[model samples]
Target: MLALPKPVKRAIAGPPVRRDGQQLDLDIQLLLRLLTPRRPQPVPPPEQMRAGQSFVDRVVAGPEEPGVRREDRTVPGAVADLRARLYVPPPGPDVVDGALLVYVHGGGFVAGDLDTHDELCATLAAESGARVLSVDYRLAPEHPFPAAVDDCLAAFAHVTAHPVEFGAAPGRIAVGGDSAGASLALTVARETSRDGADPAGRPVFCLAFFPVTALDGHTRSRELFGDGFLLTGEAIEAMAGWYVPEAMRDDPRLRIAEGDLSGMPPAYVATAGFDPLRDEGEHLVTRMREAGVPATLRRHPDLVHGFATSLGIGVRPRQAVAEAAGALRTAFALLGAT
Candidate 1:
């Protein structure tokens, strides 16, 4: 094996030590602290406008670091147009042959958009040597279940079919997102496989960041992390109710863990320690492996949900994004080579 550089060696060695014996990684901790509420905000009523507003606020204001170019564009498709924010990394000319990461921003199918996920998308592109296409897919209550899923699938297909238009390698594509977006990525991957066109040669891999895999509302984390953790059970359940209609609550497309993982691509799943969806994410990882799909699950024991979106501000949250980014790059590297 080739010798790694000093920084890379150190990064591999793990995070720095603290005097209190509570050592934490710099990048991983970034999002954790940023997402941690400043002062406890009372849980908003389920499916209420105020709750949705609060959800958007946390995501948008979490991380706005310096140095990442952002651009907005209208992604034209057959049914509806999708709003997208493209995150172009700083000039690293050597990092050519960039792949396209069609990202669906997480908002529980209710709130959240390009602005909320700006930092993480840019950070991923810059760190992973890929172009991040953050899709502002339609939200819920106004849009609902299959609405966001349809938009995500359309946006991904549109981008993959016309890679040159987005300055990406036609055969190199990946899908990812945090929370609701992550769940959608899983759905789209399955749908793409069924069709078999794979304009970009199948999504190379999926980054399921704290994804809500099973929406039956029976996981233990939901009760354990119901209160103090950044995302309360009440918030997640409400978000689920808004994103998915009463009729399709049990649909495997939205509730990924219940679906067949038979031919899905390799996945790198991140689970927040104090998150209600943690068990679901872990379950998906286990199922992926059981179904012969390569997968790895990383649980941030001290972190809460939505950590990756806060990459630039907090200690643990930033570290979480960085860690996820590194995993993304490595996995995609293998996919690209294959």
Candidate 2:
């Protein structure tokens, strides 16, 4: 809805719901119930679906955060120059100056761009007091597989090399995003933190919001929440197919959870209890911790996938983001101290 629907307003104002040991946020439940069609409908072509993504973001995320300052520019990518947006939050005593988040936008690897996640970057910049650079990596089906991965790594390298050019400090660079973007961030972390990697140059922290850690796998969470949840299992597969071929589904880039996790930056992986990717995201935390990385996992039991972007819908989403921001602040402090 471009504006909050009456049903959504009612859901936001009502008490939350308890179901199956997980409390679904009332507003999220209402939105899912209202948006899901009564009968199956043909999935739109990629171009049409991309157009609808912009419209849906405006409707769900509302206006971008008011006080944040935005600048549009281009950043270096491995295969091509990519459009980018830099967000500088309003300065205040609480602001953690020079903290940088190389933010990636997620729309199942095929649909999202910087505009779809505009308010989200602003929210992260404002809440974390970090300068967030939103990357518009080449989408799949057009760019496919390693294009996204290569572009993100190249963007991260550019930001680290010229932090002041983007109004960020050199050592405070962090990588973060939601869903597919998060998957890319984790891959960056994995590559940058390999054995013999320079500790001082690697990402100091990573933030993942309900990351799709595995493209092929069946889990209880997927079976339970695959349908009628904000992100369906079928939808996940369709989007992933655009990014990866059937034979390459076993590649570490797509099946990220099974990859080696040693030497990763301190990480925060948040999962929504009612999300199909919940189990995989949680599994990422265990894998990271087992690898001796200082990683933390926060499960928002009341939320679902995509809640991180709906700042206009309810408070829970913002709260979850705020927590992630706090983690960034702490990581920045540690990085600065070193």
TM-scores of the candidates are: 0.82, 0.93
Give the Å shift of residue 145 in candidate 1: 1.3
Each candidate's lDDT (Cα)?
Answer: 0.72, 0.84
Which RMSD values do the candidates have, in order? 7.3, 2.6
Q: How many backbone overlaps does candidate 1 show?
A: 19
| Best candidate (score: TM-score) | 2
TM-score of candidate 1 relative to the true fold: 0.82
Please write out the lDDT profile of model 2 over residues 228-312, one tens digit for every residue. 7768888887887788877776777666667678778889999998999999999889888888889899999989898878877
lDDT of 1 by residue, 20-98 (tens): 2234344433333444476777555445644654564554444454556788887964367878888777667524376
Candidate 1: stretches off by over 4 Å: 1-67, 93-96, 195-201
RMSD of 2: 2.6
